[model samples]
Target: MRLMPDEHQVRSLDHQWQLGNTRGQMRTWGRGQFRWTTFDLSVERGPDGKRRIKKTTLTDTADLKNPLRDAVLAMGWSWRARLSKL
Candidate 1:
């Protein structure tokens, strides 16, 4: 069987969450009208004291809402907490 890479989109009513590496640790689901190429990765503690992650998409950067309304804004926030650090 042929194989293909997973896919994701920005839209409303979409809830994406994952934890992995830059190889394929992206969760994108929602609505919007922006074109994104990729998302940058970084390690930062969240306000919840859970040692959460911080995503910075290559395009959007205004606000993040599942099922996003703007492609650029849909940057990255896959509901994931952190990568496996393996």
Candidate 2:
């Protein structure tokens, strides 16, 4: 996926979007409607005093692919993904 950084946000053709200090969302079409999966993002300091980004998926996504995680890793940031029960 070719993600273009627009200011503090990154967007791709697949409709993956991310904003600063805010939740991100992925949109997919299914069952004659749009399905949305949200991601909660946070930045924290790691044990080494470096910044780490935490991304938590808030809902079950219709698609199995995770472009956001791939994008974050591509940016060379310390990141992790978590699955939320909610």
Candidate 3:
């Protein structure tokens, strides 16, 4: 599945800008109704002074049966991979 941000979504992303959440992500799926998932990314320094990416998924929902569940999950992982590159 392709995740393309629409005009409204781009506008909503302005909130992230305002909050200085440069490394966060927000994604949604579904048509008439939607399921949203968000990730917050942060960086912390360890005792060795190394930096690492910390990610947190902000949305929690029941895992109901869906025919496309596997594909959707795969897509989410692919998205995460792309994020890691950034």
Best by lDDT: 2
Note the Cα lDDT for every prediction shown. Answer: 0.42, 0.51, 0.40
Ten-residue stretch with the least lDDT total in model 1: 77-86
Tens digit of per-residue lDDT, candidate 3, span 14-70 = 111123245655443222223446689999987899998888987533243133445
Steric clash pairs (candidate 2)? none
At residue 55, give the lDDT of candidate 2.
95
Alpha-carbon runs more than 4 Å astray in model 2:
1-34, 61-86
What is the Å distance of residue 16 in model 3 from its true position? 20
* Candidate 1 stretches greater than 4 Å from native: 1-36, 60-86
**Winner of 1 and 2 under lDDT:** 2
Clashing pairs in 1: 10-30, 10-31, 11-30, 11-31, 11-67, 12-31, 12-67, 30-67, 31-68, 60-72
lDDT by residue (1-86, candidate 1, tens digit) is: 11122423322232244466778666554332333346888888777867766788775433443234343236542232222221
With a 3 Å backbone cut-off (N, CA, C), the pairs that clash in candidate 3 are none
Could you tell me the lDDT of residue 68 within candidate 2? 61
lDDT of 1: 0.42
Compare the candidates by TM-score and give the number of the best one: 2
Better of 2 and 3 by lDDT: 2
> By descending TM-score, how would the candidates be arranged?
2, 3, 1
The whole-model C-alpha lDDT of candidate 3 against the native structure comes to 0.40
